[model samples]
Target: MPSSHLRAAFVLLLLLLSGCEQEAQAPLDQQLYIWQRQWRPAHAEALADSRADFSTLRVLAAQAHPGAGWSRIQVDRELLAADGRPLVAVVRLDGQLPDLDLQRTRADILALVDHWRVQGIVMQGLEIDHDCASARLLGYRDFLRDLRRALPADLRLSITALPAWLDSPVLADLLRQVDASVLQVHAVSAPENGLFDPARAQAWAKRWNDASDRPFLLALPAYGIALVNGRVESESPLAIAGPRRELQADPQQLAELLANLRRDRPEHLTGVIWFRLPLPGDRRAWRLSTLQAVARGEPLHADIRPDIQQSGPLHEFALANLGNLDGPLPERIELPARSCDAADALAGYRLERAADRLVFTRLNEGRLAAGQQRALGWARCEHLDQGGSRVYP
Candidate 1:
């Protein structure tokens, strides 16, 4: 072809590529991780509330430790089956495990699959949540390969990948064995840096997309943690008592990241799988309404209302959050009441009683989850009205 014609052809090709890059992608698929070790009565309600926004349920089935034998959580098969969503049984191998007991692990997973089948809950996939060191990627890859071969051909296999593996040379080989990978971008490091850095997470996603050939999901944080005396406290039954600093995943930041990812989605980047499903009584996790709204890439706001309940002379002061976003606890609550008897604040606040008004100053910042009410203080006043009650954020 002539020089002019060839140049025109090259420009046309560039235009086509640019158009493809700018084309809007479909909304990413969202999944939920039911990571509770023990099933609860609240799980039913949580599932019902999050049904619309999420498409898949990744239930934690079994966990294996180094010396301690593995334990299993008995999920309500009937409840899960009735929900009618695709279920993925997740088996977690503790990173501290010295070696992978390939045969035993496979046997246990097959047993759980059989158990669920008998209970009429068909599992669509199996995900291995192992945060192995980058050096062990080869061994982990071999384990996944063996397990994949042992399982039924129809049952999909996946792994929960770590950001640490980005530097490993074998990441591609490891990803090749699984049908998909869930890149955990939250709580990957020490708690001092905070959980879920939006900029770092987005950069990691871009790098992971370039590295993996299979479809992958980002495991984002929808919860917070308490660091007490350098010990991290998550959603566990054990309570560590000390002065604790709270680190939470900001909803607005996460929403903005999701919006950006949606606008310029990476190749093979499927969607996000939130860290854990939030129950109504879960203090560390965000509210179900908040999680759902965040998943939908919607704007967020916290509605903190001052709630004053009275019975005769005894009046109770509380703050109720009626919005869809969980946020920092209010710094102060001011109430206009003339009391003759007494007034006291709750554990998180200190009371300063003035002649005309009372102030409940926050001692420490805590999370007031959406759709929840927190008691601040109580007062035995002759007459207390809600007119001048105000909550400061």
Candidate 2:
């Protein structure tokens, strides 16, 4: 009717549409990377446990190195399909190689995809996990173009991007070749600097979002690694020998970061891909329960305490983790005892006897998975106050 009334109605309509668009935006998708070289029987349990929280599994299917040539992981098909989630097979190429044998590489990946399809595993995408240097990005782009052309029309293509490539001018061209990119923000640099830094990772995600037009995911660390005499051990059993340091990606730190990302996410940032899937006995990785809590943005805590089983004057000491998060064993534990006859510590700890107390000092850093226990030592005393024991970080 009136021009003033028409203007007021138009402004209200615009505001309503904007609110609707914001409400329609979905929460960030969560994915997991199964980087374990071998698939064990425990993987079935892991997959079943993780099926609810994680939407997809990006599995390491095969790898090719300069001198090593090619190697493939024998993935358990039943375990892969048990959860009925989306799957993405990843082919790793050694970044040190001067040039790639494009023909063989292409053939191996296609054959793998074909075999999986025949086995009834529907692959959502094929990812190229190559940590190529910024200078070699041009060559990498060419390889991705070749591989993308050979892949099936329905299959999506993606690449594992490194934050180190942010400085390269050709980064955009590489992103153009893939449907998506996973920016790995953990363990890309030296181990001495630590496995992950939340602030630095957020900054990198922002920069990557600005550079790439396609949707991208951030690969965050969900595990710890041991540095032994300048060597990094990821999947191997950590040896106590030589100078060693344990570096873990804390769940609380990651949870905080995820909350910030949720509050103010980048435009092209689609989701996050947690580094390796956690298994029951994998000492280096986080427990599935704890990881799930982190994905849901729940608070993290570890309730590690000294456990004592007594039989008369004999007392067996152990550390028990009762909380949801797996964490490092405490540096020291002190217990009050009287008239102690004998005592000794376990392999990773040393026992110190005082007049009124016995202390167990850690000799090397170790992790106690949630709901797990490790025997620390034993003590024989006339009267041991097990309830009075204390653990120190």
Best by lDDT: 2
Which stretches in model 1 have alpha-carbon errors above 4 Å?
1-25, 237-242, 311-314, 329-332, 336-367, 378-385
Q: Write the per-residue lDDT of candidate 1 for residues 1-393, one digit (tens) a residue.
A: 999999999999999988876565556899999998888888888899889899999999988988777888889887998899999999988998887777888898888778877878888999999989988889888988888888889999989989999999999988899999999999998789888899999999999999978999999999989888888888774465678787889889999999989877888898899988988677788888888888887779889878888888898888888889876788888888886389999899999988778899999967777888888888998856579877788
Each candidate's lDDT (Cα)?
0.87, 0.89
lDDT for each residue of candidate 2 in 128-216, tens digit (9 for 90 to 100):
89988888889888988888888899999999999999999999998999999999999988999999999999999999999978999
CA lDDT for candidate 1: 0.87
Clashing residue pairs, backbone N/CA/C < 3 A, model 1: none
Q: After superposition, how far is residue 239 of candidate 2 from its true place, in Å?
A: 9.2
* Clash counts for the predictions, in order: 0, 0
